[model samples]
Structure formats: C-alpha cells, structure tokens
Target: MSMDVTFLGTGSAYPSPCRGASAVVFRTEGDCWLFDCGEGTQTQFMKSPLKAGRITKIFITHLHGDHMFGLPGFLCTVSLQCGSNPTKQCVDIYGPVGLRDFVQRSLDISHSQLVFQYRVHELLPSHDQCPEGEFKDFLSLRRENSVDPEDQGRTIYENLEEGSYELVADEQFTVKAFKLFHRVPSFGFVIEERGRPGKLNMEKIKELGIQPGPICGKLKLGATVILDNGQKVSPCDVLGDPIPGRKVCILGDCSGIVAVGGAKLCYDADILIHEATLDDSQMDKAIERGHSTPKMAAEFSNLCRAKKLILTHFSQRYKPQELVTDGDEDITVLKTQAQSCVLFGQDVTLAEDFMTINIPIKKNN
Candidate 1:
C-alpha cells in the first residue's frame, strides 16, 4: 500500500495570495486524513484533485487563526454537500482545548449545522506528559508552567472517553502523536503501518491438497486449525515473518520541546515534515516568535535521524520564483543554503502547496 501526502496550504501565519494556511491531506486507499483547516481551505479543496467527501478525520494543530479559521467554512460545506447520507456518518475531529466550543458556537450562531454528524475530541487540561523511561530525563528539565494547558501532547489515538489510552482505531497503519513547543499546545503526528505477514504461496497450497477456500483464509488470518481429516495447519508454516511498515511524521510549529520528549518524538521517521517558517538569517526572530528557522529544522532532522526531511510552512516573503530566480548567490536567498545542505545529506525536499509526495516502499522478497 502507498501513502500520498498532498499539501493544501504551505504558507505561515500570514495569509498570502499565493498560499492559504497550514493544511495537508494524508491518503491511503479508502482513507483520507486532513491536517489543519486554515482559511480558504474549502476553496482550496475545490481546486485540488481530491474529493471533499473522502476526508474522514481532521486534526487541528493549534488555535491560531491561520490554522483553524477555515474550519467553520469547511463544516458548512460538508453540511451543504453531505445532506442526509452524511448525517449518519460521523467525522472524527481532534483538536486542542476550546476547539469544540468554538466550532459549536460558530455553527450555533450561523445556524449551519452539518448534515453529517461530528464527534469532536478536545484535548483539554493538556496531556503533554512524556512517556516513561528516557523521556523522563528530558521532561525533568522543563519548567512546570511552560507546558500548554490545552496541548494534548502526543495523542496516539482518539478514544470515546477523554482519558482513555487504549487503541481507538486499529487499521493496517497506526497513527501516533507527540507534543511540540509553540505558543500553544501543538502536536506532531506519525503514521506507521503495521507489519504485514508474507503472502500465501498458491502453488504450495495446491500441493498440500488444500482447496482454495476458507482454509486459505485461516492461514492469512494467522490461525492454526485442524482439517476434517485431522490435519494440522499453522500460519508460520505457510507464511514468512511479518515486514515492518513505513513511518512518516507531520509536525506543526515548534522550536523543539524538552518536555514532550523533544527530538526523540521524530526519531527514525522515514519522512519528517518540520515547519520552516524563517530563514537562517532570522534565527533570532524565529526564536522570539516561537518558530523554527530552516537551519533549526535541518538540525532537528539530523538529530532525530530521520531518513528524509521535508521543510514547509514558509513565510509569505519567499516567492516560488525566488526559490530559483535569485539562485543561491542572490542577496535575498529565500531558502537558506544550510537547509538545502542538510536536505542534500539526507535526500530531503522542500515541499510546495498542492504537491503530492509518494514515499517509496521497500519491495518484499
């Protein structure tokens, strides 16, 4: 299976005519996951190649206007298009505190109730506590009040109950979240596929005198059973060991937080999407604004040991043509050479809005 990541908006806090806000679509076969709905997101969707109805889950990074302003509009659009069919369908929404109230009030005042049902999971009172073991070494150094109250740090899955830690949705892939450092509680999500068992050898099945029926199903289901003739069959006898899945992480804004396990959260990601809102020249400005410069992004990528890094959430000051028109020698280099250098070492790419990146999957022997 292949995962496709398409950026809907790539601009930073300010709205540029060229880009909208922060939004990306993570797609696999029948599932479409949306990350952040900035202003004009619905309009952006209309222009994109994906179908709006395919979005089953929506994740909000923070309460920034640029990150969440488009939610109501998108919800309204869903109401207009979904109608009665969607009324039975529930769209699971995950966001920081006050998100449910904000969206609820917007719909209540506008009288634009969605035709589809939506269950909003608010990360209230924060859950950014680090996991036990090595993470404790990092969190011990952070100030007590430095954490965001609404930051649901590292939300792995959304359960029906608020404090439930059980796996809420079990599919072929697992989606895990971790906390990041920003003005508000922001989260980074890592989508990892579950290991898959080897395929059935059809020739061997026939050779074993097993008919092509539910018996084959038993093998694939990893079950051992006795045949009518008292024959024994086991999954291991037929299939090879399970293969590990690909890992990809998408993070919102942050300068790396020690409290939420910091760089460790992004470790070993096949593809890491770190926000690069500023250039190397503005490192001080980036720190003041609670954002990361491109060089910082590179440093974090290297520290996390990610296979590939993708820098996004660009400031409006940088234009697409400027990325090439001015060249690396230009006075106003939109992207820092340091950022490109890090990417070159790890095969990272600077992603653009509306671009779909396909991660190459290993072929099983």
Candidate 2:
C-alpha cells in the first residue's frame, strides 16, 4: 500500500510568485481527498500529478475566502469533465454551517450547472453549548413568514448526529476530525492507516510441504487449514509480526494549541502539517491575527510528541534569505524557517508548493 501527500499551495491569505494559497492533497487507495481549496488551486493542480476528477471528498477548514474560493471553479471543472463520460462522479464536501450556502450562492450567481452529484455536510462542533438556540431562531423566523420549515432546505448530511469524531473508516484507513481554536469555526484532521497483516513466510510454507494452492488463501485469512496429510497449520506458523501503519495530522489555521481534543488528535503523529504564518519574532502578531508562528508550531509538535512537523502558510513579507528583525537583533531568514527543533527525535520541515511527501509503512522488527 502507498500513501502520499502533495502540497498544492502554502501561502496564507495572499498569493505570491513562489506560493499560491492553502491546499493539500492526500492520495491513497487510488482515491484523492483535499484539505483546503484556496484561490488558484485548480491551476496549481494542473502542475501536479493529481487530477480534479479523482477528488472524492473535500474538507474545508473554514469559510475564509482564501481557503475556499477555488472550490466553485474546481467543482465546475470536475462536472464538465465527467459530462463527457458515461459514469457520473460524486464529490462530497464537508465544512462548517455556511459552506452549503456559499457554494449554492456561487453556483447560482455564475449560472453554472453541474452534471455530477455533490453533497454538502455541515460539521457541527461536538461540544456545542447552545445548539437549541439556533434551531429555535430558525423556527421562529419560519413561523413569522408562514412557510413550512421543512420546505426551506433538506437536512442531507449532519456530521454531529452521525458522530463527527470518526469522519471516515474503512478496511484500509480511518480519518478523524477535531475542533481547533481559530477566529472562526475551524477543524483539524487526522488520517490513520490500519495496520497491515504480517507478511507470509513462503520458505517456511514450502518447508512444511504445503503446496501453493487455495488452502494458502485460508491461512492468509487467519484460518487454520488442514493439509492433505491431515496436518493442521496455523497462520502464525508462517507469518511475521504485523507492520504498523502511518498517522498524519493536518491542522487548519489555528491561533494556539487547543487543549480540548488537541493532544488526542495529534498524539504520536508521524507527520503533523501545521500553519506557521509568522516567525518566532512575530508571536504577538500571530496571536492577534489568529495564526501561529513557527516556534509555537514547533512547541505544539513537541507537546503532541509528533515525530515530524511540516510548517506552512507563510506570510508574504519574508522572502528567501531576507534579513528580518527578531526582537532587537537583526537576522537573515529564508522565505520559510526550515529549522529543526528536535524533541525526542522529532524534526521540522518547511512546506513548499508542489512538494510531495510519500509516507511509507514501517515493518515490525
């Protein structure tokens, strides 16, 4: 099994000649999923190996324009491509409450018709304090207008009711979502690949006089097989220890490390992709703007015991090898501070547009 992550864009709020915007693509099991779709993301996709049609799902962090502007155009392109084919593709979008409205309004204004099917699922925070207040307000408005409340819109997808913790689970992997602290409602995602079964020892099987046949299939399935000689063979007799899978944590724009569910979501992550919009010198500015600096991101990685950290979402001010003031002292810094803060063997990296990271599964010793 192969798992890869491609960084489509790495800039925050603005686009530069070097960086586009915020977008990340995870490809596994022959399917692709997008984290955020910023402006010019479709153009960035054209430069990478990913195809727009392969995107089965998109998880938007927030309703911010920079993180979601390219969604409408990308969806339109996917719809156009699928129209020529007989099979119609479907892409499900998951985001905050206002996402559905934004997409609907964009499509309506542009007069864009989609041939493919798409569904929007509104993500509700698990620990919502006043959920009933919003519902009551909606009901009150509907009653004042003398219209059927049900006629307003269909409740197609509700992540809260369906258990928002586990976003996706299958035989191959599982994806989980956690709330993050941001100016607006935002979320972080964790994708964990399921551990693979131990490799079969072909030499041991041959030594046991077991021929390669259908019985081997049963053994692979952990079923005890009775050979032609009436010998019972267990899978453990010819299988090595199981190999551990990889864990990846992708965080949205966050001001600080959220205590609630933050540690759990990122605990022991193999790769933690975090937003580092500012350097250590601009810590106060980062907090004011609801973003994180590189030092803070490194500390968060240390707190979560993450094995590796990939920092992204850089501000446009810093260029490669430009001198900047860090407190009273002046220091030359690169476009991104790709410095390593080793904590229990953890390393840090600076993400660049179109950079691909291939995550490999580790075998048991």
Candidate 3:
C-alpha cells in the first residue's frame, strides 16, 4: 500500500446524510490534489483532517454536477481563507471542455473576488479538429456554443502511452488522465511516482572501507566510484534493486473500461479506486444507466492486475450496515459479490465518507 487517500465524499448523483458527493483527496507531506469537488466539499474539509487551503491541483472526471458543482464554491472558500490570512498560491485545474466556462461564469455571476490565481486546462476530445498545442485561450468559449458533455465517443485519452495527456509531471510523480464510458463524457486518472534509489548495504560499505562522503552519495546515484586506494567500487556491489514507483488509479462513474486497444494505462496499478454503484442483482440496470456493479468493478480490478481495489460511488439504496457505529466499512454484500470476481485474492475495500487508506511504498531486492 501507499501513503494516503481520503474520501471526502462517496455518494453517487447527490449528497446524502451519510455521504457528501464525489470527492477524494490524495496527499503527501507538502502537497494536496483533489479528484472531484462536489457540493459541500468545503464543509467536508472542515469535518476531516485535510486542510482546504493546501489544494494546489484539482482534477474533475466529468462535468456532472455531483462531481464538480462545488468547484466554484470551494475555490471561493479557499480564496477567502487566503485573503484573511494573506497567503499567495495558485490553483491549477483540469477537466473536460466547457468546464472552464462554467467555472468562470459561476464566479462572475457570484462576484466572488478571489485572492489567488486559478487556471483551468480543458481536455479536448480526440475528434476535435483543433490541432494539438494550438488551443486558443479558454476565453474563446465566450463566442461559441457549449461543448456537449455527453457527445458520444468524446474522449481525451486516445493514446495513453503517448504521454500527451499528462496533467502533472515533476521530480517526484506524474498524473495522467484516461477516458471512461459514461452517461456523460468521463475520465479516470492515474498517479505514478518515479522510481526511487535502492537501499544501501551499510555492512558492505563498511567492508569496502567506504566512509559517509561524496563516494557513497555518488554510488546512490548509480555511479561507480574509484577509492583513493585505486580499488574500483560499483553501485551493484553495494546497492539493492531500485524501488519501483507506485501507480494509483482513481476513476469516475463509468459503465466499463473501454474496449481493449493500445497498452492499458491502468495495468498493474498499486491501488484502483473504482465506482461500484449497484449490486450484482442490478447488473442489467447498472449498465443501462452507465454504472457498474460490485462484480464489474472486481472483474476490472482483476483484469488490470491491481493490488488493491476500492469500490465507491454507491447507490442510495445501499443503506448503512445494521448496528454499525458511524458508517459502513467492509460492507457484507459488496464483499461477498466482489470476492468471487477478484482473482488471486486482490484486496477489495468498500469506500465510505472520510475513509482513509494508508499505502506503503513497494520495495525491491
């Protein structure tokens, strides 16, 4: 497992008494990224340990109200916090086309003055005739009709491995988006960390008479060093295998993973957060409505070789487990139905509001 993923909301379509909407936060020491911003998300931040002010990037899977209606309000709230305390930061957002207009219009209508700078990068569908890297500024939306969110066959990730749809990539990690089939144009996101340096063998270093200096540091950087005694020391002699990066997939409400094609982006993910909105008994209706059942989610997780599968975006009919204290975790029916579909004992977790999963880094020897 990895570090932390907190569910700010888990309900589908709308906010319920037990759940907010569709929102999740992935956080590390000095950064925070929000997956969705449903209504009351700011209030959810107040209730959870996640601070609202630290959101530097936001990824919206679609234009649905439940998935992004709160974005404008949350942005306003964050701006208010900064205005009062005087902190300067920028918020970068990514989503399907028309999202920028919606946000700008909402902000304009409300006249909410923000103390920070925020930019929305819209992901255009593959069929768009517009050339790559030549998209005019979002202000161009003012002169055109709204791009339909449910335009059939609309998708931004036609080629996942081309590295063209990357949203964030830095020294530590990368974030990319892939298409999803849904009632509305939807997407799934993957967060991948760069490989880390292998652990050093202290005993071997001591045996080689290597002191804690630039020599050891260069070895960690996979460079061979020659000692003052004219002996050659190789990195392989002291360093274990490099640690593979973690890959996490967070998806939007969808009927299924699209038809197989080029290399699958979600293959072998460390954690997969998928929407299992209905029970197996409602399989027919689930797909008709552009949703998935526990069995569907479990099968997808297995197909992708995901180490951990988290099922979320539950239907309102699935009430809390009887006599449960705060909320349902380890839901019985979901587990029972999904267990059969998950091969090789892949971990399955039923998501609840405020549920947090701590994942550890993968180690290699």
Candidate 4:
C-alpha cells in the first residue's frame, strides 16, 4: 500500500508564472484528503492524474485569501463534473471559524449547489486571551468558536489526548491533528499507518499439534481455552505486541523555536511539511510577515527530528531559471542551504504545482 502527497498548488500570496497558491492532496486507499485550496486549484487538480472525485475531506490551514480563494471554484467545478452525487459519502470541511458562512455565501451568491453532502467543523481558541499576537488579524472570524483539545485528540472512540498523540480518523490507518503556529489559528496534521493487530504464530500453533478452526479464532480473540484433549493454550503464547505506525507531520507557517509550547505537538515525525516563504537572508522579513524562511523550515524539521523535510509555500518572487529576475542570490542561496542540510542541503526540494512526493517507510525485515 502507498500513501503519497500531490501538490495541487505551491505558490504563495499570489500566483506566479509557474506557481499558484498553496494546496496539497494526501492520497491513500484510493481516497484523497486535501490541504489548502488556492486559486486555480481545480485546474491544477485536472492537470494531475489523481481522481478528482476521490476527495473526501478538505482541510484549510487559515482563512488567508491565498489559501482559500480557489475553494468556491473547485467545489463548483467538481459538482459540474460529477453532477452532484459522485459518491454516497459526504465531503467534510475542517477549518477555522467562519468557514461555513464563507462557503455558504459563495454558494448562495453563485447559485451553486453541491450534489453531495457537506459539513464544517470549526476550530476555536481556549480563551479570550490571545495565545499569539500573530493571530490578531484573524480573531474576528475565529473568536466565535473554540475547539477543545480533548475533542481534537480523540481517535476512533478512544481518548488519546493523555499523550502528545490523538487519533483523527482510523480504519486501516489513523489521522491526527496538532495545532501549529500560523499567523492565524491553524492545525498541522499527522497521518499514520495503523499497526496491524498481532496474529497467532502459525508455526507455533502447528508445533503444538493443535487442530486449527474455531480454536484459532478463539486464540486470536485473546481467550485461553482447553481443547478437546484438555490442553490449555493462551493467546499471549502466540501474539506479539502492537507496533507503532509511520508518522508524517504537516505544519503551516511557524516560528522555528519551541516557545509558548507550540512546538511540542510536532515532535518526532517521520516527515515534516513546512512553509518556507522567504530565504535566510530575509529572516527579518520572515519575522515581520509571521512566516518562516527556508533555513527556519529546515531548523524546525531538525528540531522535530523529522526524518525528511518538504519545504513549501514559496514566495511569488522566486522564478525558475530564465523566467524572471525578481528572485535574487539570497533566495537561491537559502534554497541551497536547505538542500545541503540533508545531503548537500540539496535534500531540500522546491515544489511546483502538481508535483507528487511519496514518503518512504521502513520495510519490515
């Protein structure tokens, strides 16, 4: 089984010649989960080979125009193409406050109606006091709601909020949400492959000279039973301990440091997807914009001990070779530095629209 990430749009505040706004799709089990939807995202989706109708969830990082402008168009286009009821399942929109009203307004004004069902789950803050000053601009829309940490961390009916990890949705795998440090209230997501339940060791069972049938099922059910011959066996004799799953963390704009406990959520991820809107030389600029530089992205990835780092949300100033002169040596130099940190620091990759990246998980020996 493979879980992969496809970039629908990788541009910043505005669209560039080669880049669009920020959007990515996490594809697993033939289903798609979207993160952020910038303008022209539907066009970008069509360009990619991923099935447009497979999208089941849309996660918005913030209410920034660049992050959400394409949503209305994308939804309407999907409705037009799929004719409303593409599938029986509903498309859930998870985002900050005002998302439902915003989408509703767009639908009402455009006279667009979706064929499929939709729901909005908004995230709220803990108190009236602001946690980060960066979020001041977005308070008007978000202050009306609040998300309980306990509610955010529970997975599959089991409450895991006691630990740093909490489950989001789990079937074959589990998805978790961790709050991040964006200028607005935002959350970073972690999708992990659920570990398979331990199975009875067939060879051991065979060596025991036990006839397999309901006995095997009983053993798998963790029940100790006496067989026809009065022989007793325990499930512990055959089953193994539960193993951990592959972890991938997706972060929006954040300060590289662990100040204010915001960085605690991202610890020890296998892959960290972070925003790098500026270069190292523009550290002050990054701070001013409440964004991160490429170096800062790398630094946070390292801080989290993330096995790999994927830098995204590049500024509109950057251009591919021979495209434009708006980009300078500092931008190129910072990119090089990011790449060098991994192998030559060249491990840092600049993303364009429609680029897909597959995370490599360790194979069982």
Candidate 5:
C-alpha cells in the first residue's frame, strides 16, 4: 500500500493570494486523515482530488483560528454528504481541551443536525502526567463511554481527568500524540507503519526444484513443507529479511526546539512536516509569537535525522520571488537557508498548496 500526503493549505496566520492556511491530508488504505483545518480549507479540499467525506479523522494542532476555523463548516459539509447518502460513518476528532465544546457550540448555534455521529477525543495535560502503561486503561474507559448516548461527546473529558488516551492503533499502523510547545495547548502526531513479512525468495525456491504452485503459497505463510522426495523446507530457509516500516512525523506550530517527548516522537522519521512561519532573521519575533523559523525547522529535522523535510505554514509576507524590504527574503531564499541548515544531501522541500507527496514502500535488499 502507498501513503501520500497532500498539502491543502500552506500559509500561516491568514490566507494569501497564492496560499491558504494550515491543512494537510495523509491518505493511506483509502482513508484520509486531516491535520489542521484553517479557514478556506474546505474550499481547498474541493479543489484537490480528495473528498472531504473520506476524512475519517481530524487532528487539530491547537485552538488557533488559523489552525481550526474551517472545522465547523467542514463538519457541516460532511454531515450533509452523509445525510444524502445515509451512511453510518463516524468522524473522530482529536485535539486539546475545548475542541468538543467549540465544535458542539458551532453546530448548536447554527441549528444544524448531523446525519452521522462524531466523537472528539480531548488530550489533557493530566493525561500527559499519567504513568506509562496506565493510559491503556484510560483509553479503554473512553472507548466504553463512546457507546452511551448521553456520555458520547463529553465522556472523554469528564471521565479521564488524570490520563491520556491512544489516538489510533490498528494492525496496519499506529499513531501517537505528543504535546507541543506553543502559545496554547498544542500537539504533534507520529505515525508508524507496521513491519511487513519477508518476501519468498523465488530464485532460491526455483533452485530447490519447487514449481509455482501451492507449496510456494504455504512457504510464504511461514509454514514448513515436505517435498515428494522427503526434503523438508522452512520459510526462513527461502524467505528474505523482513522489510522495515515507514515513520512519518507531523508537528504543529511551535517554537525553536520541540519538547523532549516530541523530539523522541520524531526520531529517525522518514519524513518530517514542520512549521516554518518565520525567516531566520526573525528569530526574536518567532520566539515571541511561539512559532518556528525556517532555520529552526531545518535544525529540528537534522536533530531527528529525518530523511526528508517538508516545510509549511509560511508567513504571508513571503512572495514566490520578491524580497522583503524589511530584511526578509523571498521563499526561494528561505528554502535555501533551510537547506543549508539541514544535514548534507538530505531532501528538503517547501510545501505548496495542493501539492501531493507519495511515500513509497522500501524494498528489502
């Protein structure tokens, strides 16, 4: 299976003529997971090949308007789509405290009814304070309350006062959330795909006088088979080494260095999607506003030894080619500066609206 990331909006704070605000979609296994839904994000979705209805989960970075203003509208659109089709699809939203209330208030005030049910999993600092293995039980509590109609929306916040819950876990992949250092409560997400079994060595099998038949299938399943000549063969004897999985780290708006937990979450990531809302010369301004500059983003990528870096959330002041009169350079200069800070020969690219990057599976050597 292939995993692809689509940048819906790449600008920061506000929408510009060439860029919108913060939003990206991670598509895999025919499901779409959205990160940040700033203003005009729904419109951007309409422009791209992605369907808003395919978005099963949304991870909001923070409560900032630039990061979440389009949420209510997008929810309404999805509700309308589900209403027309009458499906039993449910959308799960994960974010900091007040997210559920903000979404509920928006729907309530507009008197809009959703055809499909949606759940909001709020991440609290108390959850971060819990002991390591304790969060599993806390997550189980949240899951239990999900079935109760009265407790559906408010259960996670009310019941889990001192623990955090798992964002996502399945056979194919797992997603973990870590707190980010920002002006308000924020989060970063790390997605790790499960390692796949080794491939059957067809050349070796042919060498062993095995034909392309049921025995090959059995060998692929890690079974031992005996040939008609009484030769026993195990899968490990013919199979190659297992293929390692891919790691993707998507971070939210934050200052210079990520939190220790966040850094660990990003370690050795195949791709690092980070916010570069300011130029190198604006370090003080970035610190004051709790945002990262391009150089800082590059440095963070280096610290994590990320194989690829994609920078987003650019300030509106940066045009495609024009230099700023206030000492800030254009996007090209920013990209160049960020590349300089990255480890030698690593891939680094700036994210543009509607750009799609495919993460191909690596073959075992």
Candidate 6:
C-alpha cells in the first residue's frame, strides 16, 4: 500500500524556466490527489509520466495565484481528455472559501464546456463563514453542475476536536486537514494510511512443526489453533509486531508555526512537506510575505518530530546549487548548540520540479 508523491511544481510566487509554482501529486492504488495547481501546473505535468486526466482530486491551499492560478485551465484540459463518459472520470476539488466563485467565474467567462463533472468541497474553519453560493443553484445549472448529490460542490465545515479533522477516509487511508496561519485563510493536509496486522512468523510455525495448510490461514485470522498432538498455538505467539501506518503531512505556505493544535497535524509524520521560501538570513522578509525560512520549517519539523522534512516553495533568489548541490541533502534540521546558537543537519530534501518520492509501506511480511 505504498504511495508516491510527485512534485509537479516547487517554486514560490511565480513560475520560472527551471521551476514552476506549488503543485504536488499524491498517488495511491486507485486515487490521484493533486495539491495546489499553481501557474503552469499542466505544463509541468506534461513533463512527468502522470496524465493530467487521471487527477481525481485537487486541493488548493489558498486563493494565491501561485497556488491555484492554473485550476481553470488544468480542469478544462482534463475535461477534454476525460471524454463524454461522465461516470468514467470526474474531478473533485477541495479548498477554502471563494474558490467556488473563482473557478465558477473563470470557467464561465471563458465559456468552457466540459464532458465530465467536477466537484469542489470548500473547507470552512470555525471562524470563517461559507457564503450562500451556488449550492442552491445546482439544480438550475443543468449539466453545468453535478447531478449526483454526492459529487456536487459543497462546503465542509471544520470539525476538529484537537487540531485534527478528517477530509476523507476509507478502509485503506484517511486524509486530514488542519488550519495553517498565513496572510490569508490556509490549511494543511495529512495522509495517514491505516495500520495492518502483523505478519505471521513462518519460522516459528515450522519450529513447532506446523505444516503449511488451512491451519496457517486460521492463525492469520487470530484464531487459537490446536495441533494434532493437543498443542495450542495463539496467533500472538508467532506473529511479529503490528505495523503502524505511515503519515505524510503536506502544508501550505505559513508565516510561522501554528501554536494551537499544530503538532496534532504533523506529530510523528514520516514526511513533512513544508515550504522553505527563504533562508534564515531573510527571516524578516519571509515573515513579511507570510512565508517560511528553512530554519523556521526546521523548527516545525523538529517540534513535530517528523522523520523526514521535504522543503519546497523555494525563493527565486537562490540558484539550484545554493539551496542544495547535486547529491547533497537539502532539507536541513537545526538543533541548538546553546541558547541561541544552532547547527544544521542536511539529512532531508529540497524538492524540485518532477521529483518523485515513493513512500514504501513496511509490511509485516
């Protein structure tokens, strides 16, 4: 059940020849989730092996152009390729308020028609208000809006108890979103895979002279099996430790770490994908623009005890070598040498366009 995250675009604010803006694709067995369709995201996708038409879901962090300017164009292109079979493929979009208005106006002004349907779910924080928008006009739009109630555009109010709220979930995984402090309303997403049963220890079974047959299957179901010689074997006696699910936290741009309930969003994350828009020397400028420095991102990663920190949304001022040279780890971790002094550990990564990271599932087997 391993998932792959492909960095479609990784630069901040604007698109450059070398780097585009923020967009990432999280792909699993049956789902392809696109996070932040920045300017030229479709162009970036052309360079990767993934197909734009396969994007099942799109999540926008904020209304910033760098994060969602390409949504209209990308959606149009995907609609064209998805063909007339509405059931064959449809897109789901998630974001904050005003996203529906933005996408609606953009598509309307262009007079673009789609063969398939696309749904948008806006995440509304407790402090925010979901304006009475087209949710009531869905029946009037005819083919313009999704006919299926489940696939129609809607608002999702925040229901976090302790900084944790699920966006969507199934038997395999759950996607959670939390508030992120920024100049505008922003949010972060966490993809937590469900845990699995421990592997059956065949070596131990053989040690007890248990033959491979229906008994092994019964043991897998956690049943106490009796041998022909009147021996009882519990599933726990031979199974390995249960494999805890993996967690990947993907954040939007943040001026600084959130004080309330931020850790619950990123605690013990296997990979924390955060923005490092500038270096520590540019802390003031970064804060002014509602962005983060490498050190600031490091602090969050450290506070969350993340296993690997993947830094993206780099500032255009730096060259590829300046941030991270070839074969050099880039996502730096800072630890205090004294009350104010700090040391850097380049063990994580600084993402670039088209960077693919496969998060392998550690199976009990």
Best by TM-score: 3
**Global CA lDDT computed for model 3:** 0.81
lDDT of all predictions, in order shown? 0.71, 0.75, 0.81, 0.68, 0.79, 0.77
Candidate 1 vs 6: which has more TM-score: 6
Native-structure RMSD, model 1: 7.4
Writing each residue's lDDT as its tens digit, candidate 3 over 1-365 gives: 33689999998999987878999999877678999999999999999999999999999997789999999999999998878765666688888887878887899899987898777777764422222343334435643446444321123444544433677789888987776667666778889888888889999999999999899999999999999999999999999889988888999888875544211678888889999888898899988778998999988888788999998998766766773554444356876798889996888888889999887888784
Candidates' TM-scores? Answer: 0.80, 0.83, 0.86, 0.81, 0.84, 0.81
- Candidate 1 residue spans exceeding 4 A from truth: 84-88, 125-168, 206-209, 226-233, 259-265, 322-345
3 against 4, candidate with superior TM-score: 3
Q: Which residue ranges in model 3 land beyond 4 Å of their true spot?
A: 127-164, 259-263, 323-331
Write down the worst ten-residue block by lDDT for model 5: 155-164
Q: Clashes in model 4: which pairs?
A: 84-115, 124-146, 124-147, 339-345, 339-346, 340-344, 340-345, 340-346, 341-345
As for TM-score, the candidate ahead, 3 or 6, is 3
Please, what are the lDDT tens digits per residue for candidate 1 over residues 1-365?
A: 77789988988895576777998898888688898999988888898998777788888877778889999889888778767575446777777656766786788799886777676665432444322221212222222355453332332343323222222246676665666667666767777776777778777777678888899888988999787779897887777656667777888787665342546646777888888787878788887776887778777778778888788888777776545354322323435444565743776577777899987665554
Task: Put down candidate 4 lDDT per residue, 93-124, tens digits, no spaces.
Answer: 77666676688679879999888767666654
Give the per-residue lDDT of model 6 (tens digit) for 1-365.
65889999988889887789899999988888899999899999898999888888888987789999999999888877766656646677888767877787789899998777787777764332112231222223324444564666776766656665567888878887887766666788988888876888989999999998899888887789999999999989887888888888899988754445767667878788988787777689888777887778777777787877788888765555456665433333211111122123424677879999988886553
Residue pairs in clash, model 2 = 320-335
Candidate 5, residue 7: how far the Cα is off, in Å: 0.9
Greater-lDDT candidate between 2 and 3? 3
Model 4's TM-score against the true structure: 0.81
Arranged by lDDT with the best first, the candidates are: 3, 5, 6, 2, 1, 4
